[model samples]
Target: MAGSFFRVACQDCENEQVVFGKAASEVNCAVCGTTIARPTGGDAEFTGSVVETVEAR
Candidate 1:
């Protein structure tokens, strides 16, 4: 198996992110600088909405 990718969102900042490879202690919101929790995985792919609406990419 490759790995699982997790989609993270900051409720306050409305910043969405994709995290992989290593789990992080604090994920900063690029737009608003809010910290989020990142999970563990690696080499993941993005989808339509997750890339469009959420992730900003």
Candidate 2:
């Protein structure tokens, strides 16, 4: 499956981020150090609000 990018907002700091859909490592918020996404074998499991999806055209 083709991977995409997701625009997410941190739950604690409200910081916006662009994370990999299938991130192989933990993704944290730059502003608050909050755990935003975690590796789940395939795609990254997000713990923040999904602001939008970014796909390559």
Measured against the true structure, the TM-scores of the candidates, in listed sequence, are: 0.46, 0.91
RMSD of each: 7.1, 1.6
Give the best candidate by TM-score. Answer: 2
Model 1 alpha-carbon drift over 4 Å, by segment: 1-3, 38-57
- Model 1: how far residue 6 lies from native, Å: 1.1
- Point out the worst 10-residue segment of candidate 1 by lDDT: 48-57
lDDT (10s digit) by residue, model 1, range 3-55: 34556666675567765424444456677776554433533222212332222
**What local lDDT does model 1 show for residue 15?**
66
Check candidate 2 and list the clashing pairs.
Answer: none
For each candidate, what is the lDDT? 0.48, 0.92
Write down the TM-score for model 1: 0.46
* Error at 9, model 1, angstroms: 1.4
